[model samples]
Target chain A: MFGKKRVAIVGAGVTLFRRNLKETGKELSYEAAKTALEVAGLELRDIKSVVMGSAPDAFDGVHMKGEYLADGAGAYHKPYTRVFVGGGTGVFTPLAGWWHVASGQFDTCLVVCEEKMSSCYPHPQYAFTTIFDPILERPIGMNLIWIFALEMNRYMHKHNIKKEDIALVSVKNKRNALDNPIAQLAANITVEDVLNSEIMAWPVQRLDVSPTSDGAAAVVLASEDVAKEVTDNPVWIDGVGWCIDSTHWTDRDLYYPDYVECAAKMAYKMAGIKNPPKEIDLAEPYDPFDYKELHHMEGLLLCKKGEAPKLTREGVTQRDGDLPTCPSGGLLGCGNPIAAAGLMKVCEIFWQLRGEAGKRQIPGDPRTGVAQAWGDLMQYGSVIVLRR
Target chain B: MRYYQSEAVETKDIKEGKIPTEKFRPKAKFAWSAGIAISRFLEELKNGKIIATTCSKCGRIMVPPRIYCEKCFKPADGWKYVKDTGVINTFSVSFLAADASRLKEPIVVAIINLDGASEGMGIVHRIEEYGDWREVKIGMKVKAVWKPPEERTGAITDIAYFKPIRE
Candidate 1:
């Protein structure tokens, strides 16, 4: 229901996620873009426009990173644009691609998301220090983990949830990662292992967090006309939505994510989904932190507030269960390369819907899936619904 | 599905010049303007006072004052001095520094809702002088401790840290 022209994701590709990738950001972008083009049975010349998504300039240590990555993203000598919404850029980039085709401006668009977080000296977390208010919050010497801990603490306190309930996510996701060929931190760990892991911040152990990584993911979007000619299994982009909350994250209640709910509602409405818990076959809500999957599930209206932990406890979110969430291992299991991680979730949904997830595939015939990405100081949410 | 490609590198590869990479350390320093509202707030902090903006349209008082009310999309009506004491909204005990390095003493940080500001209008700052981080709880009463006037600077750091108000 996107105007006169509909957009479809015909092909998608992703590079291996790692702590320190040897390839430059451009090379990673080229690897992902080339694969996507190859999968779509299209050449670089077939693309009419290009959209690039990267996190921060600080992460790559290069200003005008979009221009620097243009050639690698196959945007050379074409209409190109870069979109940024912190961590939301991955899923958001495809939304930009949708517009390029939906607006009838271009029949085909290339969407690429890349991040080289390891390039930052000492540690990539240092690049995050500049994300705070230089005058106010920066002086306090904030680590990115602290805000997550603060929010996790508030969420647990509000729901009377225990650390054990949250650790199960780590256990489930990492185990799921073992089936993923490109997974970086895949393991068969127990909940106790998560609780016993190193504590970076109270309520946020190291294992609860996804590792800093470098990688790239790319997807090819085309009009319905072009999609039918390109691939037999074209995943239609049924709905796309994004919402950004106020920048004053400190002033807002951290117990729940209201912004994600807003964005999810927008996409759900467009997709004509009356009951998200039933209509959507599977979901890939961002899981940079283990608690985030539950938080976003509630936000996405897949479950009621304070209900996700119970759902997880019941194994309802397992790959073969009633609703398989993050079946592609998620950011916790698949390394988090920020922009690439968000795009990876979109890629996972595209593959799952096409019955190409291999060992990580859900058992049932899943037709519709939702992928979401959260970013920008915990204030941004991007959602896309795809149907095969 | 099997076409995923990437090469992982270790720190030693770059450190020993084995990766054939060039390292550049940027020295880009910035003087961020505290802007219209925060400029006055910082000045007040140096004078040992906490100020907040009042939005008559929305009937909300905000800390870390802003020239315009973000909610109402208009200039705030005026400024008000909020009490130094407030309740802790949330807190975290951080064992790691900004660079992901371990710290000898874990820093306890909290978002404190100033007494007279609107509900949930809090400022992020460190919580200190507590025997243990577990003692710091949400809804706990606390007050800001300012640096000596002689050493005060017109910045958020003017207030050293927020401490628990012992009954």
Candidate 2:
């Protein structure tokens, strides 16, 4: 949508998604950022600006985490900024970098996202409790799973959907993750396995959720001229959109995500996409929870409302399916490092478009893809459209 | 860039002191002001009543009251007491606590849209199980089971939990 310089992702890099990584958050950022620069054939001196995306500071047990992670992200002498939109920070990071280059103020930008959820004592889920409203929601002693379970129950009850139907998403995504070398919780499981798994919250079993992980991902954004010089197959950022709804999530119906639809429509309009189910080759809708994939698919307008579960059941969302979704195994298959997980989706789009996603690649020659992330009490959505 | 992978560490390694680690648990605390809107709301709750702020222009009543209407962007008309009863908007049966610890008695949490509040304006609270957990369903009517007035505090917990209201 920018009339100035166009922005393109020249290279993408990510560390192995794992439950516990030996490296600190900064070290993980350095590892990912170094590889991104190396793949782009650019040095630290070439980066004009840097954008770092990290979720809550509670996860890393470090306050002012942006400044703490800045140097490692190669922002030594460059203009640096950090974006935090809860889990959507990953995709939003590159969107910020895209603007840095598209505004014609910078020729190249380095975007990195990192999350060290393992650093949170007891469990990373404990860090999530702080996200609730202190005066209203927090006093009730709620965990993160409660909200997801409540929403899942509402969605299931509304659609008359069976738990087995939702479990298939976990089965498919985990199976897909087996092909990804960096995937953490990748496994060959079935709907039965997911259904029989330990119940955390009713309707949300152990397998229904993505693992909390420590990892980092990075991508290099460059102006049109710089992109042409850096790589032969640069993935162009066609459009970016983000939206946030009311902070009082309890006041709204949980069956559908109107915020996600708003953000997707904005991005699609900017990308000149009128029919997403046909025009978009594939997609990476956020799937921290298995049912969320279906929720976001409808939000992305990839299918009719309440049709995504049916599509998943029919193998339409499979890697080999018509509208391959989350072919990188998604958050369920790939480990979910929060911010890193969202950026990982963006990186997957870059790899899939360039034919570099070895075994996880969709068979058909896919050109256009959309990566979306939802966060912050189910109120925020970030969407990015990319093309080869 | 080739053959790059992150180093994975085992939690047992850190637990067994194989990995040198520094642990610090800070007591981070804060005293939040209830402010004008919430202070009155809390006082009403202590009196076994649920109060909401009404917007004169939009005719919207907001629970967990706010001084100004979000839609109208004006001072709310005044405070109004809503019914302690509400419908279960959505709920969850949790076997874990805030610290992620397994609990002996599972907590049934729900968002209740108070009877007199505008549509979608609700407060999150715990649901007390009357009998079978299976009996709980969405759209079930519920009423606040308040603590004794002497035991009541000016907080959300003043109403112990919401139980299903039987005909």
Candidate 3:
């Protein structure tokens, strides 16, 4: 891994995370890409290539969706590539961009991610039906909420963790998101409010879920040679790794994200990170569901296995505490717009690394950070390590 | 053929047993962002016009324009709008519609890679007035049929379907 090239995310930008957008997906992409380009001090013309990622063609209600999003990402004349790993697409977007530069090929790459979940009629959750096997899974009438409920149940059963212990994550993250500019569900609420909320599929309360959103986030990546010339605070993408488990999601242990462990090992190995719990200063482990953040924490080796709920309960994961995670409020607080939400996690790390996150910045001088997004039939973990 | 139903129904009631079973069907709806190139391309289609996004990095003139060239790493430059006519790439006989309801007749589902589009790039739609599945074949010539202006809505079905042109 010595010859592994250095990939730096010089700039990042995001549109307002919301439920509905008047602007179609392309306009959102333009808005986000413009901001990222401005931060990177480059125009669409300067981008040598484009890497675009969105969850599924079904969510967008458009077929050949990657090609549909190409121009919006300023990919029309560039060597454009689209890689999607379900909800992992957001994190994977930059990973795709990272490879473009790390391979000693491209210089400037614009990585864009967008998801408009509002368009799916009745409810956005209906879109999840297509994620299942048309032949077998669909026959059971599986909805996405049930899988989350089962995972939460197993997590609760395994850790001897009470419902109240998990509520703290929603409370803390939402409170932390108050200062976030693009926060969607940022609010101040007690654990009682969470428990009192509507239970969609048992164990998984409606409040525990991230709001369906329409959002886009873009990041510009360049080689170290060119990045140094543009900005002094170039956050290096030290390592990136993604792993997906088998499709039989029902057969796997729902208590943890097993794929995340392998993905984290791959990334930690590349970044030369020995003790993630001590070495990595901050993290934004994907939290589309409250328990998932804790699930990814253990998988990322932030603490010993099954210790995340305890860490979460004791306020260790808070912005002001040891190992501040999801200081940008996270998808649970800010919003979950599929791919955009994941990149938002990546952007927060960049801000923390540069001391430019303003009110959302972590307490200490955070030199090392990791962002992980897991999705795709609930079996993928896309991990990234960035260091200042 | 006509005498079997009444006797079979009476005999089935007299047979040993029948097991209770179940079947499931879900109505799937998805909202998608058309993005820039394709949205514009779709809008132009409603106006009886065709648009293609060409990657300057790679000279692929793509119908249903792409934001990125998937092949080259760069922003697309050339914008070419043309008449609506393309050759059939692949097709099938749809025995049932989206609702899983039976149709009076089977419709022809087709994938058409418009003449100017890149390799294997095109739109999926029904081949209008093809009579039946037996009539249409791969590589059949077809052209767009515009709906009346009053009936226009911004969707794929705006142009009823492509039909065989009188060449």
Top-scoring candidate (lDDT): 1
| Chain A TM-score of candidate 1 vs. true chain A | 0.99
Model 1: residue A332 alpha-carbon error in angstroms: 0.6
Which rank order by TM-score, best down to worst?
1, 2, 3
On a 0 to 1 DockQ scale, where is model 3? 0.01
RMSD of 1: 1.0
Q: Is the docking of candidate 1 incorrect, acceptable, medium or high quality?
A: medium
Per-residue alpha-carbon lDDT of candidate 3 for residues A1-388, written as tens digits (9 for 90 to 100): 5334678999998888876665567877877887888888887877898988887876666878888888888888789888888988899889889988888888889999988776565566766767765432343345666566656766776677788878888888888889887888899999999999865555667678788888889899999888998999999999888998866454345667878999999999999999898899999999998888888999998998788888988889998889998999999898898999999999999989999888887888999999999998778999999999
List the pairs of residues colliding in candidate 2: none
lDDT of 1 by residue, A187-257 (tens): 99999899999988998998999999989999999999999998999999998899999889888898889
Candidate 3 falls in which docking quality class? incorrect
The top-ranked prediction according to DockQ is 1
For DockQ, candidate 1 versus 3, the one ahead is 1
Give candidate 1's fnat, 2 decimals: 0.77
TM-scores vs. true structure, each candidate: 0.98, 0.98, 0.70
Give the Cα error of residue A260 in candidate 2, in Å.
1.0
* Order of quality (lDDT): 1, 2, 3
